[model samples]
Target: MVAAALAICLRQRGLNVGVMKPVETGVGERGSTLSDAEYLRAAGGAVDPVDAIGPYRLAAPLAPLAAARQAGTVIEMDRILTAYERLAAGHTLMVVEGIGGGLVPIGHHFNVRDLIARLGLPTVVVGRATLGGVNHALLTVEALRQRRIAILGIVLNHTAIPSGPSGKGPDAIATRQGDSTVELVKELSGVPVLGPLRHEPMLAQAWEAGLGKVAAEDAIRTLADLIMQDVP
Candidate 1:
């Protein structure tokens, strides 16, 4: 979702934005609801075909490698790179979202990190702002750093505010926990940390409105500025 919003922001800034998912899981057959790739395409207002945007759309909502295996298929890196280059050719910048975390498997032996290294794109780590986020966020940053990938920044997203033992309310202890994760991550992560993007469920139902709101955010704007600096 953050990636989609970033695409929207880039386009709003007057850049010819291109979006790609490389591999998308749980994408239903033709006539089904909008998949992540479709949402991203809409975000950028791109006219590219869905095949070029995603390249691989697996039916099962599993990891790319697992879903491809279930469908009796294989994920070829060359195919993905071909699609990426095709889209990149006509756009100012390509926003390629990872299938999952950096370690997500694509082929039998390849992972998302390998794909990123191959694409040679700087990445913005989007972490969930909740308890245990520190570990997940830091580990991801470390993984990218180990591979010598340029770290753009981190965006901590608050997916939801769950109820604590005190019961459901804004003052729930879990809310505080979620809020604290952002601070904890910032204190520890040496790389620039961008957002604690508030939970916005509307994005699933209203693409433009939801993304428009996110695009107008100061954080998203700042992140966009950073991305522009990194990309040629």
Candidate 2:
């Protein structure tokens, strides 16, 4: 969902965006079901074939190295990097969403964080905005920092919003959520909060069109603005 949303957001800004599942595993005879290459192509209306999106489509749906091992194939790092560089060439920004958590295995000895550290791209760790999320968010942030990856920001994906009446209407609700996120950002490494993504149909459309919803637009733009502010 965050990948979809980011694709939409970037597309709306008129930036060329490519979606890659990169190291996919667990296919029967077809292919990886969670593949985002097609979705991104369709969303971006790009003529580039999905193959150009750099999918390592594996057949076991396990960790890349494990799946490759199970299938008697090698997980080639050079190949993966080549694919990523190919798509990243013409775009100002490419949002590469990982398969699982920050620690998912990528190879014989490396994990997902290792992949991000190698790529050296600014990364936004997506986390659920629910109970226990703080710990998960902070720990993941720490791990990524330890790996030396530049932390772009934290994106709190709200799976479900509490149902209630707010006297402040949408603006109020947004303000309250924004304040909470700002507090979290200040407390955690001073990384900006990219805002919460509420599950909604408009969000799907905005994502497809690459347009940021009101909240996402403000938050993403603010992060961009502030992150640039820190640039010397």
Which stretch of 10 consecutive residues in model 1 shows the poorest summed lDDT? 162-171
Tens-digit lDDT track of model 1 for 1-232: 8888888898878899999999999987535678989999998899999889989999998989999999999999999999999999999899998978999999998999999999999998998888889999999999999999999899988776765566656646667787788888889989888778877877778867887888777778889999888566
Global lDDT of each candidate: 0.88, 0.65
Residue 79, candidate 1: Cα error in Å is 0.8
lDDT digits (tens) for residues 58-118 of candidate 2: 7686777788788887766677778788877766566676877788887777777877777
List the pairs of residues colliding in candidate 1.
Answer: none
- Residue 223 CA displacement from its true place in model 1, Å: 0.6
RMSD of 1: 2.0
Query: Where is model 1 more than 4 Å wrong at Cα?
Result: 29-31, 163-168
